[model samples]
Each structure stands twice: as structure tokens, then as C-alpha cells.
Target: MSETQMPAGQLSGNVLFYSKPEPLAKELHSKIGVKRMDGPFKFAKVGHAIPLTVGEFPLAAVTGPIIFVGDEKLPIAVMGLNAGENMFVKDDGTFESGIYIPAYVRRYPFVFANDEQNNQMVLCIDRNAEFIVDKGYDMAFFEANGEPTEYTKNCIEFCNNFEVERQRTVSFVQILKDLDLFETKEATFTPANPDGTQGETQKIAEYFGVSEEKLNALPAAKFVELRDNGALGQIYAHMHSLVGWDRMIALALTKAAAQQPQAANA
Candidate 1:
């Protein structure tokens, strides 16, 4: 995935949130290190949803809706009602306390690239990350001896574990595919009329999800198989996460009201 140098303006993968990713090498980046950032997660505001591994469903479900995308069929946690607006992210680029943040967001600026020639995964970093600096900073990528520093080692471990989780997520998706469990799903909201009646329903979102009807229809043996394989729990988590759509609608209403023009005193 990496080479002696990643040509200027060239990026290797389609990984989300990475810009100008380059392979980490002591020869090319010995002076480069990470510094403390003022608005660390501001970059995340560009996306309304963040990808999630199946392992994160239960924890992430409590915070927001987790649904599968059409193209990738991978689960993502929806954070905002509109595109390019991550409601969970503050204007200062910080996530609020006591909320579950996706690993995909926290692992920013670092990702793994496949080294095809060497048949291995190599560490890469977004060359344009605001936190990365040259010399005497918060943490160095490598020591002068051409070995990874403690901080770099920790980052490598985290990335490796994430890859393992990601692969496991793929297997989980395949299992669901085999069971024919996914179905198209939509979310909607209805406003209260001026008097008391409910207003017309409006479509809020459309995505794929594990259909409870299909899940219930599985043969006893097949149901047992899913339960034994630890997928049933994840399925329930996904289903439960749908409730978060209400939370999103509420937040969206609040945000919309804030953006409305105030009437001057009559």
C-alpha cells in the first residue's frame, strides 16, 4: 500500500476521512510527529454518518441509528439529519462527553494500506492532518534508530485490531446475506397540527435493515445457528437502534427552530 513516496496529490485508497494519505516511513517522515490539536474532530463534521463495525452496534445503538448502506451493505451510525452536518460534533470540533463515538472517527489520520508486493498491511497517515507536525511535538512517528516510537506502536496496534474487526464485520454481513435477512426500511416523522391533530407524515430516511419478520420465520435449526454464531445479538442491536431515529428527528427539529428567523416585537 505504501512506497518510497506517494506522489504529490496522489491518494491510495477510498477510505473515508483521509486526504493525501501516504505510507509512513522513517526515511521520508522522520521529522514528522503529531501535535495536540485545538479542533481535533472538526474534519468529521463533513459527514452526517460514520461507518461502524458490527461489534459496535450495541454501544453505538444507544447514541444514534445504525443502518446498512445500499452499495456496501455496511452499517453506519447516522448523526445528522442533513448532509455535511454532524450534529454530534460541536462547533469547536469536539464530541460531547458520555456519548459513544465510532472508532472510524477516532482513528482518523491513521489507516492501514495493503502492501501488495510484500503481502502485508502497512501503516499510512493523512499527510494533511492538522495534528501532524515536524519535530519536537506531542508524539513522534519514529525514533532516529528507524524504529517506531511508543506512540507509533500504539497506533499500529489500534489499526491492526480495527482491520481484524472490519474483517469480522464482513463475515457477519455475509452470514446475514446467506440468511436473506436484510430488507428495505424507511423512517418517517409527523408534525403536530396547529390544533391537536397530527400532520402528514414525511419521509426521513431510507436504508436496509434486518427484517424482524424474516428473522422470526427462520427454521428452528437456522435460528439456533444464528444464535450460536453470535449474530442474533447483533441483529437485535441493529433493530433496537432504529429507535434512535426519533432522537434524530427531535434534534433536527430543535436545530431547525434555532435557525429560524425570529420575529421582532410587535
Candidate 2:
């Protein structure tokens, strides 16, 4: 498909950390010199469901609800309830102050790519990123000797660390799946009408989450095994993160009201 036709989570081939990623080459690097990030999140548009690693559950739990996305059960931070809207992002493009920022968002503009032919990972940058600058910048991808600059080295290191955490998250999700701990869940929202009456209940989303009943029914030895393996904490963290679902609904309601022409006129 063409770049414009790419779905959410998928970006142009040159965009790293996107669902479809292409290698960052020296040629592209030359064109995009050391540009500093322009806005708080010019790269991230509305409705971007950022993938969360196992290490991020604690902080992410406080910022937003963490839930499984497709059949593979990939965990994601819910940034918006509806399509094409990010409630956490202000009109100035800055994220809400004091909210816990997920590592997935912090590692942006840099990512690791799988080099299948060489059986290795390659550090890459999004050539189309808003932060890229061709000249008059403090950072450079390569020095005069063609060696990577310190800035490039730091980005590579962060991408490598994120990759390691991503792999660990895969293992964590696999264990949950093997134990049959996940179940379908739904989040509902009921808005209050202007007349002081309850509005119709709306089911905003359906996702997969840890089954509390199954977790409680696990054998004592199995529970001990999970605790020993450090999976129990992650599970509880995910469960606790559900508390943010209501918060998400409230934000979504506020956004909806703000967008309504009638409300705007009032």
C-alpha cells in the first residue's frame, strides 16, 4: 500500500518505531543532519496506541490503562478513546504535565531494525521525523572521520535497551498466554445529560486482560512459581492499571464536549 493508505501504527517505510520500518542509511542520514526535536511530540499524531514493555507497567499504570491489543495480545497504552484524537496532548502539542511518560514514547525518533539477511539488528532513525535537520544543528549523525557522533551513539544505546525490554515483554506475555490467564474485557462509559439524567451506557472498547477468576484459582504451587519468576507483580500491576479506564472515559467525554458546536457556542 501507499504511504497515505498505511493504517494507524503503520507509517511510511522510512519511519522507524512504526509497524513497517526500513533501514536508515548513510545517504538518508546525510540529508537529515542533526535536527533537534521541534515540539513535545510532533512525530506522534492523534490516536497512536503506543506499545508498552514489561518494564513500563508500573509507571504506565499510573498514566493510563494498559491493555492487550490484537490476537497476539500485544500490550499498548491507550492514548485516546476514539480515532484521531489524543486527549493527553494539548493544543500546543505538549503532553499533559506530570503524567508518566511511557518509555515507548521517550524512545521515539530512534529504533532497532531486524537485518534478516545479516541475522542482526541495526540502529535506525526516522528520516521523515520532524526533529531531523540538515544543517545548523548541535548534533551530527557522523563526524568528519565518518564515525558516529556521541548523540548517535546515545540514540543507538537507548534503542538497544528498548529492544531488550521488548523481548522480555514478549516472554512475559507468552507466559500469561500459556497459563490461560487472559480474557475478553469491555470498558463502558455513561455520560450525564444536561437535564441531570444518566445518558445511555456506551461500550467504548473491548480488549483482553488478565482473568481475575483464573488467577485466583491457580494452584498454590503455580502461584509460587509465578512469584518466583517475577510475573506476579506484572500481573497485579496490569490489573491495578484498570483504574485508569474511568479516567480515560472522563477525558474522552471532555474532549467530545469540547468538540461539540453547541457546547462551543454555549
Candidate 3:
């Protein structure tokens, strides 16, 4: 399909892209980077839930055209893994090639819309129009011809299994929490840094009814590495930094176990 271009006024969808910096808010510059607003465009819509899910599991979604005054050519289903569903460019406004969303997000129920707010979108394209149809929902790199590009064996496989692990781990958390295996408790685990900044460990411990000491004692970072060799690990880190430790740890294990090979080189 020839790309459809809508006037700035007609752009509308459920996604929220970050554009401006609120000085009064606690802004973490290094982690969130600078939120760059579209230079001069004006938005028609005022209130909408940021179309991002707060869960640790990554979902199928699309981001960007990084619109200016006109419709810009953007890549389709260009496959990335665990990149935030909320779109943001690098500090320099460059695309972070590592971000990939799911094919279902790209193909159905239309997760996309655009406006001057952030002048960005999360789109829902038609099934036949998607590029990664054959690749299942795992995010990966594809060429113009729609073939998986070469990478380290584990990297390719990891991308291939991204969604599977995400779904599995998220489901596990829901089940365990529902079954009361993981209880919620008030915790002091989330502690302030030497400078008084709060850390996620305490929050995470509280969420899981454990002590921050107990949480810190778990081999979480190591297990995360074992699960996906660090793909899911970094995302969990991002979730922790922005969301909290409970989500980071939960998501890490989710992504890892979903991708765990049925049997290793035993």
C-alpha cells in the first residue's frame, strides 16, 4: 500500500509520545534522556492515556514517523526487542535501532495515531502490509527483502524468542500473584541512596513482601543474564529505573524463561 499521509489535524490514536520537559517534576536526565517536543507543531488533542502498558512484558506496537510539517517515511515492523512502547529519540533525536515491537501491534486493532503533542505515533497496520509476518512475534532485524539478518547465533535466537519469553514470564507473575505465592508487604527495601535518592530495591521488596535485604540477596542479575544473555536484562533495568524493581525482576524472569531452550547442551 502506498503510505497514507494525514494532515496534522487528522492524526489521532491512543499512543502518547514524550515531547516536553517539566521543570518542577523529578526529571532523570540520564535515564529518560531529554524529552524533545516537536519544534513548532500544535496538537489538537489534550488528554489521552500514554498508550504504554505499565507491565514488564513487551507487546506488539509501532512507533514514529517523528513528524515535522509533513508525513515522513518511516520503517514498518522493523523489528526490535523490549524497546519502550513509549517512543523517544536519542538525546540527539536519532532513532535507537534497538527498539522493536510486535507484529500483532503493527497489524491489528490499530494502535497508531499522530498529533502535534509529541508528533509521533504507535500504528496498527494491516496484516498483509506487515514485514515480519513470517517471524512470529519475536522482534528481529530484517532486510528490505524480509529475511532475518545475520547476527550472533544467540542474538538471532534471542530476538526470535523475545515475545515468547515476555508472554511466559508475564503470565507466570500474574498466576503466582493470583495464587498468593508472591505476597505484597510494606517494605523498607526501597532505600534512599547516600544522596537521598530512592532506589527500586525497597519498592520491589515491598511489592513482593520481602525485605530489601532479601531482594538484594537474590541472584536476580545473574539469573537475568542466564535467561537471555542480557537482552531482557537491559529492559528490566529500564523498567526498574522508570517503573520499579518488582517489574524489572518480574519482566527479566519472564523474558528469560520463555526463551529457555527445552534442553541445554547437557
Better of 1 and 2 by TM-score: 1
lDDT tens readout by residue for model 2, 121-239: 56555555555678677688777766667877787778878888999999999999999999999998887899999999989889999999999999999999999999999999899
Query: In model 3, what is the error at residue 231, expressed in angstroms?
Result: 20
- Selected candidate, larger lDDT, 1 vs 3: 1
Rank list by lDDT: 1, 2, 3
After superposing candidate 3 on the true structure, give the runs of residues whose Cα lies further than 4 Å from its correct spot: 1-160, 189-206, 209-266
In lDDT terms, how accurate is model 2? 0.74
At residue 260, give the lDDT of candidate 2.
100
List TM-scores for all candidates, in order.
Answer: 0.91, 0.86, 0.23
For 1-266, candidate 1 gives per-residue lDDT tens digits of 23344443343357778877788888888888998887799888876888899999999999989999966698899988888788888889898676788998888788876656556666788888878888658888888888889988888788878889999999999998988999999999999999999999999889999999999999999999989989999999999999999988998888777777553322
List runs of model 1 lying over 4 Å from the truth. Answer: 1-12, 114-120, 261-266
Give lDDT tens digits, candidate 3, residues 167-242: 5545534432343333334322454477888867633221232123433444776445434643333234322332
Error of 2 at 139 (Å): 1.1
Instruction: Give the number of the best model, judged by lDDT.
Output: 1
Q: Which scores higher on TM-score, 2 or 3?
A: 2
lDDT (0 to 1) per candidate: 0.85, 0.74, 0.31
What are the clash counts of all predictions, listed in order? 2, 1, 9
Native-to-model Cα distance after best TM-score fit, residue 221 in candidate 1, in Å:
1.0
